[model samples]
Target: MRDDIVTIEPDEGLRTWGWVSYLLHLVVAVAAVLPGAQVSIALLVVALVIDLVKKGDAANTWQASHFSWRIRSVVWAGVLYLLTSWLWLLFIIPGWIAWGLISIWFLYRIVKGMMRMNAGLSVETA
Candidate 1:
């Protein structure tokens, strides 16, 4: 049998951008769960912008799933936080607990996505 090997090259630039976005997300997520250690919202916005802008570039590639994953995580967390805002009016403790849970969930998603990306796998599969 004739042997013909085909090798596909990975996109380094796309991976680099993915790492940058993931790091930004990790920072924001970690800070969110910490008391009195709030980080600037601008960092989250910047990460979102990077994901939105570069998402197109990753289309039809494995990295595309990561972009979508991060975007969805942020959107869902925002919605959850908004819905739970009324708890603050009722009682400060309830509000704190709701937000704290949401923050932990956000942190979990970020960490999971980063792990999948590092493994050169699609977040969708996880």
Candidate 2:
């Protein structure tokens, strides 16, 4: 039988992948507000792809929390966007409101993850 246990090493600082994911998400969030910028969404897609590719291997590193956090944030954000997307076809105001709320939530996740990472703490898994 294979052991399912995972050990995370103790290492923290700007040298972690967690920190890089945080910065990428932050840029995507901020770039959304910029005019004529579709690049932000592309960046977000790239970040999510990286998260997917690295998450399994991240289990043995201190960066696991960050990977988990980023993945969850992306999944949640996508769900919210999709669920609220129908509102756009009906009422413009409600759609905008939903988008705004999702944006705030996205920012919150990024900020919270970054703060925890900077403080040498792992992000909350739940």
Candidates in order have lDDT scores of 0.89, 0.74
Error of 1 at 125 (Å): 0.6
| Per-residue lDDT of candidate 2, residues 1-126 (tens digit) | 114435456454323555566778999876554535555477788788778877776675556777888899989989999999999999999998888889788988899888877765667732
Score every model by TM-score. Answer: 0.91, 0.80
Over 1-126, each residue of candidate 1 has an lDDT whose tens digit, in order, gives 112312233489988988999999999999999998989999999999999999988877778889999999999999999999999999999999999999999999999999998987888777
Clashes of each: 0, 0
Clashing pairs in 1: none
> Model 2: which ten-residue window has the lowest total lDDT?
1-10
Where does candidate 1 stray beyond 4 Å? 1-10
**lDDT: which candidate is best?**
1
